[model samples]
Target chain A: MGKNVLLVDDSKTMRIIIGRSLRQAGIDFDNIFEAADGIEALEVLEKETVDIVLSDINMPNMDGISFLREKSTRDAIKDIPVLMISTETGDDIIGEAKSLGAVGAIKKPFTPDKVNEVLGPLL
Target chain B: MEIQDKMIDATKEIFSTMIMMEINLEEITDVHGPLTDTITAMIGLAGKRKGVLAVHFPYPVALAITSSFLMMDVEEMNDDVHDAMGEIANMLGGNIKTILSENGRDIDLSMPSTIAGSEYSFQSDKDVEKVIISFSTEKGSFMVEMDLEK
Candidate 1:
């Protein structure tokens, strides 16, 4: 048993890859949960306690940005550290994610080792 | 005109450089039917150029490719590997978008979509000036389709 992590993304494929990366990285997390979009993620929070959130920035309905925006206002979800992962590497998006309280940001096409680098200290 | 060519080239480079694979279309007469073992990554090209850029690959090859790229062993193709296929497509589209500005084309991109099923044809609506570049790995068996519309 290790820390609990909430993985958010619209693609199941990506979740698997990221999950594999986490395991390969040896983050030692227990009860890995996943949400297709922010709306579902919010729902997961109601009953589950996640130590960290590894999320993608783009999604349908409630995207990563909107999720962060809304989550910032919620006292319960706000304190939980979020790591933004997506293909968009624009400075503006990074700035925005940082402002929204993302503990870290990693670009897409990322290796599992990169996941470790981002989550090592925090999680 | 060059922007389109450049985008095509970018895709070719990715498959060759990252996957250690190359694709060709000289004998691809029927680009239809089922590619059951195919791995695909699809991403949207928005803004001035709006459409989707997808990478089509054979299943094991995709798993093999991503596995090698990530340094992991994916015995069975799962949702995560499939999603990585899509993200790879997204990355190809995103990088090409960067070069569009120089050619006077402004574009916004959307997330990628990855699909792994059997027997499907990915045909583009527009055929006029429509571009489709193919790449094949030196030792791998598959093709990458860059179906982009301007």
Candidate 2:
């Protein structure tokens, strides 16, 4: 069975690109959910059975770091792995995301091979 | 690698890897002129280094790139074009940010903003170090400018 995945990003274009790349990477998902920001992402988590979250770091309502922090505190979603997919390139930010319970991080303009390599073990 | 080289590499990689478009370096110019009938996307950088990065695209180029990125035929400047431009700027700025970080400069990237118009010019602070690199592909041509307020 495939895992259920949630994708969070403010840009609709980016979401579509990421979805295409995910399929190209051969990461099959039972169900794929989309959210525009952290707040919306939390709402989706409330109703869906998601196994993994792929999120962008910068968003309007709530950013990825804040979402990860919130996710870490909730028992229902705490165990689900969060992987940041963003254009942020600071070690400080990446470290902070990890501390907040993010399993991994992928920079923008990412290739399908790189996505698969980073997410294969976690999913 | 030099800053200009880094920027060029980022642009090439993003276009080819993310958008599946092949791009070639056309030239690097120091000329500053008003961009008419063009779209420009900008991203701010802060922390150890502070500045802005802007990518300028002629209308045809912007439409072509946006269409390829969205997997649709974009006829005019619309929401998809704006979003794609912002994302492209973000990706380019993000890669450049990583190179700076590796060199021991801690930097933070801001969300991108885009502007489109028939006539307009950008004026930066006098203290900034500005570098502009131009590129072309079968689809069209564009320029990427890095303005660092040192």
Candidate 3:
């Protein structure tokens, strides 16, 4: 069966760009789910069969760090790996994200090759 | 490299990689007069440093950029244009945050916003150190300005 991916970002433009980048990288998924923020991402995770999540760190309702922390506590959805694709890629922030259960990160202004390099291994 | 140079590189990278447009640095100036028929996307920086980062794009350039960014033809100034420009500013702001703050936790970035009009002035109320870099693309030119509190 093909894998599914969830994209969580506040900017609609960014979501579209990420989806495009995924296709450009030749990463195809059966389902490509989207959420505006961490809250919506959590809701999608609960309802959908998402294999992995691509999330942004800064958002309006609920940010990625809080989302990872909250998701970790839930038994049903905690294990799904989340790879942060954001502009906030400082060691301190990325380290904290790792502590919160994020599998990896791809900085903003990234290319399809960069996305593939970082995200392909996880899949 | 200096902050201005870093900003130039960051802006170029964003345009090249994400927007699929190659832009070259045209000029580095201290002041630019009032804008006309343009849109500006800005983001604030707080905490360890306090200031703003803004990108100014004329309607034509903005339309071209939004079109290239989404791989769709954008002919007018719409929400998609605003959002795309805001995301560009947001990405530039994040790069600047990394340049200013080592850990990235020291500086907090505000939500990105947009301002569009026929004419307006963009200036800081408080004393600031400003750097404005102009860039040119096939469609037209745009400016990236950074103002940090002294």
- Tens digits of per-residue lDDT, candidate 1, A31-97, equal 8899999999888876698999988877888988888888899887788888987766666676788
Model 3: C-alpha RMSD to truth?
0.7
Cα RMSDs of all predictions? 5.2, 1.7, 0.7
Q: 1 or 2: which has the higher TM-score?
A: 2
List iRMS for all predictions: 5.0, 2.4, 0.6
Error of 2 at A115 (Å): 1.4
Error of 2 at B76 (Å): 1.6
Q: Is candidate 1 or candidate 3 better by DockQ?
A: 3
lDDT of 3 by residue, B44-119 (tens): 9999999999999999999999999999999989999999999999999999999999899999999899999999
lDDT of 2 at B102: 64
User: Considering DockQ, which of the candidate structures 2 and 3 is the better prediction for this target?
Assistant: 3
Worst 10-residue lDDT window for candidate 2 chain A reads: A87-96
Task: Tell me, by TM-score, which candidate is best.
Answer: 3
- For candidate 3, what is the DockQ-based docking class? high
Q: For every model shown, what is its TM-score relative to the native structure?
A: 0.71, 0.94, 0.99
lDDT of 3 by residue, A1-123 (tens): 999999999999999999999999999999999999999999999999999999999898899999999999999999999999999999999999999999999999899999999999999
Weakest 10 consecutive residues of candidate 1 chain A by summed lDDT: A86-95
Which stretches of model 1 miss by more than 4 angstroms? Answer: B1-41, B58-85, B98-106, B111-133, B138-140, B147-150
All candidates: DockQ: 0.21, 0.63, 0.89
